[model samples]
Target: LIQTFEKNNDATIRNLEAWSLETGQQVYKINLTGAILFVQINTDNSKMLVATNDQYLRIFNLQTGHEIFKIKNQWSDAQKEVTITPDFKEVISIYKGNNLIVWDLEMGKVKATFTTDNPLACYTVSPDGKTIVAAEIFGKLHFLTLEDKE
Candidate 1:
């Protein structure tokens, strides 16, 4: 698994970098000023999606160690979760611990907002985007449809 060890940087992230899980070789690195909330490897393995407390879900080119796209939030709300679509084209994240944000990975902007009975503490999406299974800490399951949630 490609894991992001949150740097000790309470103010500025100093030791955040990428490493290959199989070989343990340094893949790439970057600088940041907040905690890493998410890291997702693309299907093609060319890049990864990173969500930081700085409110930017950045797509980094693994080969060059450069950011290709950045989705910056207009509000400084605390970003909670980040997930990249199976096709590696859409970026989804959570805002205010309750709002689900669908971001166009290439455009880096919000495309949709979904509301649930409770905040989306954790969620999983099928590769085909047909089933979205989510769970909160209330010991219940939240079923969602295309237009309405139940």
Candidate 2:
């Protein structure tokens, strides 16, 4: 899958395209709002989580191209990256260069937050969704463990 952007004078428009690597042809395109920052498809390829510059985290049904959930952000910094747990119950995002946010997919609310002094560059969730390794711009790695408080 490939994501392409179309720039206009007002806002940056985004188009999500699925391509065929073997035939080198475009399969289909899905038009989306705002500038997309990160996209993460679920393990089953049935759903996707997209984070955009418009400060919205959207979850879409990949098969029907229908939006399932939309969560708006209150912060100012752009989202650096986003990932979904294997169970598709949680969405984790890194932003503001120093903050990590975990969102509950079903409830459409923030579940937890973590902050660091250094700017974060990237992150990945463990296969079991129990741990997160976030890399800082200064070459430091932070390992975070996720727990169910409730």
Candidate 3:
């Protein structure tokens, strides 16, 4: 199992802890440079993606506890949500509540960007990885199709 450790007073995340479910022992403890805002495990569970207060996205190897890559978030907007694509080749994130960003994992660069007029509250990609459904803060939902063309 995976869990986050935090200080009681400020309730800020301090580190990430992964424990063995079978042995009930601590597996690894990864120190964080900043409070973790988002955490995601890839499909195979070998890699972990974490977004922190430092405005960077970090990918780590779960078994070795070593960093695989890091991507600087260029936008100053707050990251609302993040997810690894079904194929684990890209990262899709929503920033500033309306900006959708797709980052290529291998290149550690932004692959595409899209924006909506209204502030988005949440979003999710279809299982087939060809569409996105985003809901506005005011409850309006928008359905978008994903394409690779630039």
Among the numbered candidates, top lDDT falls to 3
- Candidate 3's residue-wise lDDT over 1-150, tens digit each? 666565545787858888888888888888887778778888788988888877788989987678998988743435646777787777787776678888888899998887888877888988878787888888888887767766
The lDDT of model 2 is: 0.78
Candidate 1 residue lDDT tens string, 1-150: 344564462544444577778898877667765566667778777887777767767788876668897767632445455666677766666666666666667777776777667766687777775455667657556654332124
lDDT of 3 at 136: 83
Tell me the TM-score of model 2: 0.70
> What is the per-residue lDDT of model 2 for residues 26-112, given as tens digits with 9 covering 90 to 100?
766767666777788877888878777778888887766678979996445444456778888888877566889888888999988
User: Whole-model lDDT, candidate 3?
Assistant: 0.79
Range of the 10 consecutive residues with the lowest summed lDDT in candidate 2: 73-82
lDDT of 1 at 109: 70
TM-score of each: 0.68, 0.70, 0.78
RMSD of 2: 4.2
Query: Model-by-model lDDT, in order?
Result: 0.65, 0.78, 0.79
| lDDT value, residue 60 of candidate 1 | 82
